[model samples]
Target chain A: MQFWIVQSLNSLALGGLLFLLATGFSLIFGLMRIANLTHGALFMLGAYVGVTTLKFVPNLWLAALIAGLLVALFGGLLERSILRRLAGNALGQVLVTLGVSFIVADFCLIVWGGDPIPIAAPTSLQRPIVVGNIAFPAYRLVVLGIAIITAIALHLLMERTRLGAMIRAGVDDMQMARAVGVPVSRLFTTVFCLGAALAGAGGVIAGPIMSAYPGLDADMLPLALIVVILGGVGSLLGAFVGSFVIAIIYTFGSALLPDLAYVILFLPMIVVIAFRPRGLFGRRST
Target chain B: MSAAARIVLVLVLVAFPLIGGDFYINLASQIFIAALFATSLNLLVGYGGLVSLGHAAWIGLAAYTSAWLYLHLGLRHWITAPLALVNTTLIAGLFGWIALRATGLGFLMITLALSQVLWGTAYRWAAVTNGDNGLSGLTRPAPFGISLDGPAAFYYFSLTVTIVAVWMMARLVNSPFGAALRGSRDESRRMSALGHNVWLVRWLTFVYSGFWGAVAGLLFVYYHKYIHPTALSLTSSAEVLLGVIAGGAGTIAGPIVGAAIVLILKNYVSAYLDRWNMLLGAVFVVIVIFMPDGIVPGIRRWSARLRKT
Candidate 1:
């Protein structure tokens, strides 16, 4: 029972981080219909920046905010200078984004020297929280809390706000939205930046646990892709659910069948694809 | 170019290995193998309208199968090669049966998921795949009477296979089945409404793609004398996609041209600059911005405009 509880908590922590990374990817895909492969690279940049900023700011929250904003700006620049040029061409977009990912990964390697950079947990959240005989990392619980808040905040924004409405409208029908003066192009850029910011935020929160490293992007990106697919493309709620499920599979599967953990991580996805190709919450095309 | 011109071009390509230096010969061979891989990708993306981000799984599967057969079963080259191709086709057919049910972005994601599954399997199945250590020490042997140990001999063997494969693809693409696949690509619902099974066509095309990928894998295993999990990774898939896009999807010869450019650039740029990735990124950005229709299409458009003048 104690082992199960710990595993469950670990899954929540992993799921929270995955949700953060995948939220941005889902947003970009929903709005632009373009697979921003460099989204992973942006997440890496966020972790690095958050760690670097913490050295000066001395406040974890402030560092995360600054990192998120900076990553958002970088995303905006990428949209304006590169992605804008490859609009409507999926293959071109994939190639360009992949190229961008390679550049970011290699640049990180050069700057960080292939070593994992340790990030200190916030002083206030460093202790372990006791729940009966089982103790869970306080920082991980904080991460879970933050993730829940973020999801709720995003849901409210998407469902209630005017900007969110415009974004949704654009996602549904770009041509119709453009005809009604929705500024589809500008909206795409904004959404891309917003998604990047979320990824950055996730990276910042996950930094202490995972550590910022050169090859971390490769691992995170695939996990994010899996989460996005399992959750369904364009569904934020789906991302959250998918993340938890995948995390749970990872934690328990590894424990139960160590040799088959990797295959087990993919089994749920395969089953999901087999049964629900659009994902758990994907909107059906009429 | 006329038919005669094309034949002459092919002849020149074949003889260039003899005249060129060792480095150039090796480079050409690498390009040919890559071209074969890209061409296989082209069958799905260009003709079937299926953008598979995980097509590298086929190549990786073929490599591992061939290597395993050589190691455990002590299979001859001729036997193993055919077995590899057949195995790849069967696996691809199974995967495609599930994947072809989805369309557009959904299909792409499914393929990516499937590729990851294969990569994970390769990593964890240590006893069979040797985990990250990879399968090594498989050498090119005298297959049925021909010595393939020398680079020159191997290059000719690869070239012959590539030519035959390309020719087969050309014939396949012009056949009635190919026409039906293209029709489905243009409008799957309409084809299905007309009583044709779009799913079957897509699955068959996917199988063909896998067959070609397996052929490329055979050449790769022979050339490198090793196989690893990286062969099935997302990176390899992405590289093949890059080659397909850079050349021009839908064009018969686009992948070959694209493969040459990509491999040559990587070789030359990496030799001089440590930040070759930045250069590669810049190149991709420029290509997408200026040549959205790809190099072949751009060239065709320019030549057409000149002819009009």
Candidate 2:
């Protein structure tokens, strides 16, 4: 029972991180209709940036904030300079983004020298919190807490704010939104930057637990993609739900059948897609 | 080029290997094998209008299967190679049946996911795949009184396979079934509404693509004499896609041209620059932006205009 509790908590922590990474992916896909294969590279950049900042600043929080902001700026530039030109061309967009991703990944390797860099967890949350016979890492709990808070904050922002309303409208019908003078081109840039910021934030937070490495970008990209697909593309709530479900399945699966964990993770996706091609929470195309 | 001109070009290609020393012959052989890989990809992307990002999985699958058969079963190349091809085709058929249900971006994502599944399986299944160390020491067969152990002999064997494969593919593309497949690519919904099974066509195309990929995989194993997990990786799939884009997706010779450019560029760049990926990335971006129809199509268009004038 204790092992199960710890495993379950670990799963939630991991799920929270996945949700953060995937939400941005979902949002970008929804609004821009551009599959940013470079999104994972941006996430890796964030961790790299955050870890580097910590060397001088010695403040984890400030480093993470700076990293997220920098990534957002970089994303905005990418949108204006490259992605904007490839609009409405799916194959072109995929190739371009994938190219950018490869460049970024290789650049990271060149700079970082393929070593895993450790990020320092906050001193207050360094130790495990023990309750009777059960023990859990406090930092993980904090990460989960922050994830929930961010989710709520995002929900409120999207549900209550005018910007959120515009985004929702744009997602529903880009043509209609453009007709109503929604400034879609600028909106796309903003959404892309915002999604980058979210992925960056996830990267910074996950750095402490997962460690920052040259090959980490490749490892995370597939998981983020799987989450986006399993949760239904372009749905934040679905991302959250799908992240937790996938995390649980992955964690438990690795424990139960180590060799088959990947196969098991993919099995659900295949089954879901076969039955509901759009996804679990995906909206049907009209 | 005209038909006669094209035949002369092929003859030159074949003859160049005989005259151009070992280095060039090896390079040319690599190009031919990679061309086969890219052509297989075009079968789906160009003809079927399906973009599969994980097509390399089938290639890797065939390579590993053949490697395993040769290592464990002690089977010679002639018998083991056909068995490997059949295994790969069956697996491809099964996976294709499920994958054909999705269209557009959905199909691309599913293929990517499936490839990851295969990669993970290969990486973790240490006993069978030998984990990251990979399987080595695979030798060519001495069947029918012909030894294929030498590099020169292997090159000729691979070249023969490429010629035969391309010819078969050309015939298939010109056939009624090929016409139907192209029709579905243009108007899938209409074809389905007209009582044609769009899913079946797509599935068949996927399987065909996989089979060709497997054949290329076999040739690759023969050429390199080794099989590794990277063969089934997403990067390999991306490289094949890059080849399709670089050469011209829709044209028969496009993938060949694309593979030649990509492999040669990759070889040359990686030899000097440590950051070859950045260069490759820049190349892909340039090609996608400036030459969306690919080098072959652009050249063809230019030549056609010149002739018309």
Candidate 3:
């Protein structure tokens, strides 16, 4: 019972982090047809930046905020300088992102060395909270809370804001959006930055649980890829559901059938890809 | 581009290990293996326009199968080699069936995800794969009573296989099927309307590519006498893709030159520099921005324009 409870909570927490990563990835893939392979490296970069900021600030939220902003700024620069140059060349842009990912990964390794950096939660959230028969890590619960809050905030921002409407219009139809004067090009940078910020902040939040490691980008990128692939690009709901599904499979599959975990996880994905192609919630038209 | 140049190039590569020093014969063998692998990928990416990111898994899969069979089951190379090739090709069929369901980005992602599945299996399944330590100390094959135990012998072996493989690819490229493949890549619906059977064409190409990729994997194992999870890594796939792009995806000469450049830069430069990966990344960025058509084709265009001027 205790094992199940822990695993379940762990899955939920991981799902929350994945949501932060995948939502941005899905949006970037939708708005711009390039797969931002650098997003994974960005997550790693954010974790490193968060680790550095934590040394000075001592506040988890402040560190996360600073990490998010800096990473966002980095992403914006990438878009303006490189991605923008290869506008319609999807493959070219994707390759450039791959280059950037490599550069950033090496940069992180050089700066932080090869050791994994353990980040601590704020003092208030350091201790576990007790329930009837089981004690839950307060930090884990806090991560879940942050995920929910982020989701709500994102939902509200998307639904209630003019920028949200414009983004939606652009996502639906780029040419049509431009015809109506939606400033789609600037919006592209904005969306890219937003995605970068979310992934960056999520990295800080995940630091306590996963730690800042050398190959964190490689470890996390596949999860984000699976989420975006399974969830359908540009669909927040798909990312939400896909995150939990993949997280549950990843966590429990590792715990129970450690050897056959990938078989269990990848088998369903193969089946879905074979049959559905568009993913569970993918839009009808390309 | 002329027959005389092609013959000269072939003669030079064929005789490289002889005059290039005994130390570099091994390097030449490695380069040939990579070039062949790049060519196989070009069959799909360059000709079929099916850019797959997970095809590296096929290389790892075949290598693992052969290694495992030899190590645990005490099987010989002649038996294990064919078994590994067949196994990898069959699996590629299944993976291809799934991956080819979507076009463009979806297809690319599915291929990547599925490869991750294999890489994860190799990484986590310690009992079979030995995990991070990897499976090592394998012996090379001796075909027709000729032992491939020395650098010169292995170089000839790699050279022979690569020559035959490239010839096979060239024949396939000039066939009517090749024309159909290009048509489908350029306009899928239109090709289908013209009764090209686009999916089947792609499926066949994927399996064929897998076969050659497995061949590359076979040489990889014999060359290093080892197999590891890193063989199936995304970096491996990216490297092959970059080689294809940098050389000239559609041209026969492109991948050959590209692979040679990539292997030399990676092997020789990494020996001197710790930041080789960053340089590699920079190469990727620079190549994409400036030489997107690849070196061979870009050079051809430049020479053409220069002549016109």
Candidate 4:
């Protein structure tokens, strides 16, 4: 029972970080119909920037915020310069982003020199929180709390705000949304930046636990994509549910079926995909 | 464009091995193998309208199968090659059935996921695969009593197989079945209305392409005398896709040309440049942005315009 609880909590931490990464990816994919492969590169950038910022800022939260904002700014520039030109061309979108990612990954390697480094956890959150005979890393609890808050905030933003309505309208029909005077292009840039920022935040939070590395982009991109696809391509709720399921599968699958863990990890996705082609919460049309 | 021109091109490639000595012969062999891989990928992307991002899985699968069979079962390359091709086709058929149940992005994602599963197995299954250390020091098989040990001999063997494969693909794309696949790609509902089995067409295409991709892997193992998990990577898949796009999809000669360009850049240009990836990325970006139709079609259009002028 104790082992199960601890594993479950660990899953929660992993799931939380995944949620941030997948939601942004899901949103951009949903609205833009672009795979945004560079989002993973942005996540790596966030982690690296966070690590760099830690040397100067001395506050983990502030450094993370700065890092995420910088990544978001870069995402906006990417949208303005490259993605804007390739509208409605799916293959072009995929290829261009892939190229950009390659360039960014190489650039990261040049700058960071291919070493795995971790951002230090906040001093306050460094201690372990105990319950009866069980003890958990306090930083993990912070991650869980941050994730929940971020999810709720995103939910409210999408569900309640005017911009959310415009985004939803655009997602449904870009032509109709444009006819109604919604600034679709600017909105796309904004949504893309928000998505990048969220991905960066995921990296920052996951940095202490997973470490910042050159290959993190490649490793996390697939995981985030799995989360997005499993959750349902454009559905926030689907992303949340998918993240938890995947994180649990990854954690417990490793624990239980050490040898065939990857097979076990992909099993749920295969089963889920077999039944729900559009994903758990994805619309049929999309 | 003319039959005479095509014949001349083929003659040049064929005769080059005889005259170009060792380094060029080896390089030409690599290009032919890569061309074969790209051509197979183009069959799906160009004719079938299925842009698979995990096409390297097929190549990786066959490479591993050939290597394993040779190492463990003491099988000849002649036997192992056919087995590898058949094995790849079987796996492709299975995965294609599942992937084709969904359309567009779902299809791409499913293929990517399936390939990742294979890569994971290759990375983690250490006892059989040797994990990251990779399998090396393989010898070329003397299939059909042909000597494929030397660079010259191997080049001719690879060239012969590639020519036959390319010819087969050329014939296939011009066939009634190829017409149907193209029809399904452009007008799926119409093709279905006309009583064509659209899903079946795609599934068959996937399996067929897998056969060719596996053949590339077989050749790669024999040529390099080694195999690694990197063969199964997303980068390998991307490189093939880049070749397909650069040469121009939906054409026989385009992917071959693209493969030649890519391999030449990798082998020759990278020798001088430390930042080869950045250069490659810049080139790809330029190609996508400017020559979106690809080099072949782009040149054709320019020539047509020039003729008119």
Candidate 5:
């Protein structure tokens, strides 16, 4: 019973990080109708920033905040300059972002070096609490708590706010939203930065567990893609549900299959997609 | 553009091995193989209007099959070549059936997930695949009782195969089936209304591209004499994708030109600086932003302008 509970917590911890990343990815995909491949690189960039910040200030929260802010700014610039110009050209957007990601990844490699650098949790959260027979790390619990709070916060922001309404409207129909006096150009920049910030925040928060690595972009991209697809593109609830499903599968699949874990990981998505081509929560495209 | 000009181009390419030294011959052989791979990818992106990000999976599958056959079963090149095509076509059929259910982004993600499945298998199945360290020491086979041990002989062999394949692809693109595929890409609803089976066209294109991709893989393994999981990686897929976009999509020869430019840059630039990916990324950005039609169409436009002037 204790082992299963601890494993479930592990799954939640992984799911939490995935939730943060995929929510942003889905939002961007919903609005732009383009796959922002550079979002993965932003996640990597966030982790690197966290690593650098930790060297100066020993606080995890501060380091994560700094990392998130830095990447958000970068994301804003990318949106304003590059993405805005490309507009409706999906292929062009993909290639441009891909190119940006390559440069960013290489720069990270040059600065941080190739070795995986672990970002240590704060001294306060480093300790483990006894749960039944198992000792679960306090930081992992903290991560789970943060994820729940963020999910709720995102839900409220999207549900109650005028900005959220505009975003939703834009996702439904960009030209319609624009014609109705919604400043979609500015909105695009805001949403993109917001999404980037979330991914960066997820990176910093999960950095201690996964560690900052060179190829983290490549590693996390498929997971994020799986989550967004399973949950439904642009739906926060879908992203949340998808994250848990994938996290549980990953946690258990790694334990069960070990070597064939990725294959196991892919199977559920394939099955899900075969049945629901638009994804579990995806809105059908006209 | 004339038949005479086309014949001359082919003759020059066929005779390249005679004038070029061993190094040039090897480099040209790699270019030809890359061209074949990119051309196959173009069959989807250019002709079928599907941008599959995981096309390298088929190529990698065939290469690994050839390597495994050579290592474990001692199967000769002649036997393995046909087997690789069958392997690729079967997998393509299965994956395409599932993936083609969704269009656009969903399709791209499904293809990516499928490739990762193969990548995981290659990484995990250590006893058979030799895992990440990769399988090496597969020698060049004597196809039709002719030894391709030397660089020149192998180059000629590769050239013959690539030319034949490209010609077949040209024929395919001009056929009635190809017209339907193109029509579907431009206006699927209209095509369907006109009695064309859009889904079947896309499926057949996917399978056809997979077959040619497998052929490219056979050439790749034969030339390099090794196979690794990296061939199945997202990076390899992206490289072929970049070639298709940079060369200009919706054109038959565009991807081949795109592949040549990219491979040349990779080979020549890496020799100078270790940050070739950075340079390549910047180049890609420039191309996408300014020359969205890619190098081939961009050149064509410029030449057309010069003639008018």
Candidate 6:
């Protein structure tokens, strides 16, 4: 029973990290209709940037903020410059993002070399907390707390703010949103920035667990894709539930059935997609 | 292409090895295999309008099956090769039925996810696959009593297989089924309305492409005598797709040219440069920006306009 509790906590930690990476990916896909393959690369770039920031300012939270801002600026440029040029060519746009990702991945390798860089967790969260005859890793609990806070914050922004309302309109119908003077072109840039910032911040948070590595982008990209596919695009509830479910499946699968882990992982995905091509909670395409 | 041009191209291919020595012979062999592989992918991307990112699954599956059988069970290449091709094709049919459930971006994601699953399986299933250390040292077969142990001899053998494969594919694309496949690519609703069974068309195309991909895998292992998880990796699938698109997805000869350009950049240029991936990425971006339809079609359009002017 205790072992199961420990595993469940680990799964929750991973699911929280996934939410940060995938929420942005889902939003970008929902609004722009582009899969935004470069989001994974952005996540990896954020970790490296956060590591560099830690050198100047030892505060992990500050480093994460700086990393998020820088990554957002870069992502905005990418949207305005390259992806904007391939308007209406969906496949071409996807390919361009792929090209940029390849470039980013190679540059990361060139700059950081191939080894994984492990970032130390904050000192306060290093100890394990005991509760009800079981010990829980404090870092994991903090991660869950952070995820819940971000979730609540995002909910408030979407439900209570005018900017969130406009973004929601755009997700529902870009043409109608434009007709109502929503400034969609600028909105595109803004949403792209927000999504990139989330991924970058998530990257810094994941550093203590995953580390910055050469193939991290490749490793994370598929998981995010699965999350988006399993969860409906632009649905926060869907992303939340989907992330936890997938995280639990992956964590327990590796522990229990190490050899057939992936086979088990992808089989349900294929079955679900065969039945529900639009995802369980996904809305009709605009 | 004109008849005279085709004849001259074949003649040059036949004569070049005589003058180029072992290094060029080996390089040329690699290109032929890649060209064949890229062409197989084009059957889906070009004719059927499906961009399958897991196409390497077939190639890797066939190669590993054949190599592992010979290594562990003492099976001969002659037997394992055909068995490998059949097994891969059957599996492709099943995967295609599942993947074709979604069209456009959904199809692309499903294919990518499925391939990732296979890649994970290959990396983690240590006892059977040896877990990424890879299986190596397979014996090359002698066909028609001719030894293929020599690089130049194998080059000629590969050239024959590539020619035959391309010829068959050309016939396939010109057939009634090819027309139906193309119809579905441009208009699925209309084809369904016309009683075409678009699903069957795509499923068959996927299986046919997988069979040809397995053929290329046999040649790949014959040439390299090695197999690894990287053989069926997402990167490998992406590289083949890149070659197909860059050459001209729908054109027959376009993939050949595109595959050559990509392989040379990957093999020849990488030898001299430390950052070939960045160079390749830049090439992808440039091609998308300047020549969206790819080299052959782009040149054809320009020349047509030139003639009109």
Top of the candidates by lDDT: 3
Tell me the tens digit of each residue's lDDT in model 4 across B12-80. 977887789799999999999999999999999889888888899998999998888888888887788
Estimate the TM-score for candidate 4. Answer: 0.96
TM-score of 6: 0.96
- Candidate 4: residue B76 lDDT (0-100): 80
> Which lDDT tens digits does candidate 6 get at residues B70-111?
898998778998998998898898889878887776778778
Give the per-residue lDDT of model 5 (tens digit) for A86-198: 98788778778878988899999899999999888888888898856789999998998998999999899898999999999998888899999999888888899999998
Q: Which ten residues in a row have the lowest lDDT in candidate 5 chain B?
A: B102-111
By summed lDDT, the worst window of 10 consecutive residues in model 2 chain B runs over B97-106
Per-residue alpha-carbon lDDT of candidate 3 for residues B1-309, written as tens digits (9 for 90 to 100) = 799998998898778867888779998999999999999999998999888888798789999999999999999999999999999999999888888887776777778878988888999998889999999979999999999998889999999999999999988888998888888889999999988899999999989999999999999999999999999988888888889999999989899889899999998788888887787789999999999999999889899999999
Sorted into a CAPRI-style docking class, model 4 comes out as medium
Expressed as tens digits, the lDDT of each residue in B1-309 for candidate 2 is 589998998788768756888877888888889999999889899999998988988889999999999898888777888999999999898778666767777677778778878888788777778989999988766657788776577778888889899888878888888888898999988988988888888888898889999999988988888989888877788888999988999789899999999999888988887776788788889999999999999999999999999
* lDDT measured at residue B260 in model 2 versus the true structure, 0 to 100: 91
Model 2 agreement with the true structure over A182-218: per-residue lDDT tens digits? 8888788889999999888788889889988986776
Best DockQ goes to which candidate? Answer: 3
What DockQ does candidate 3 have relative to the true complex?
A: 0.70
| DockQ class, candidate 2 | medium
DockQ of prediction 1: 0.47
lDDT comparison, 1 vs 3, better candidate = 3
Candidate 2 interface RMSD to the true structure? 2.2
| Candidate 4 whole-model C-alpha lDDT, 0 to 1 | 0.85
Highest TM-score model number: 3
lDDT of each prediction vs. the true structure?
0.84, 0.85, 0.89, 0.85, 0.87, 0.86
For each candidate, give its TM-score against the true structure.
Answer: 0.94, 0.96, 0.98, 0.96, 0.97, 0.96
Q: Which stretches of candidate 6 lie over 4 Å from their true place?
A: B306-309
Worst lDDT run of 10 residues, candidate 1 chain B, spans B276-285
How many Å off is the CA of B68 in candidate 3? 0.7
Residues B44-148, candidate 1: write the lDDT tens digits: 988888889899898899999999999989998888989998998899988898678677766776787778778877887888899999999898867668888
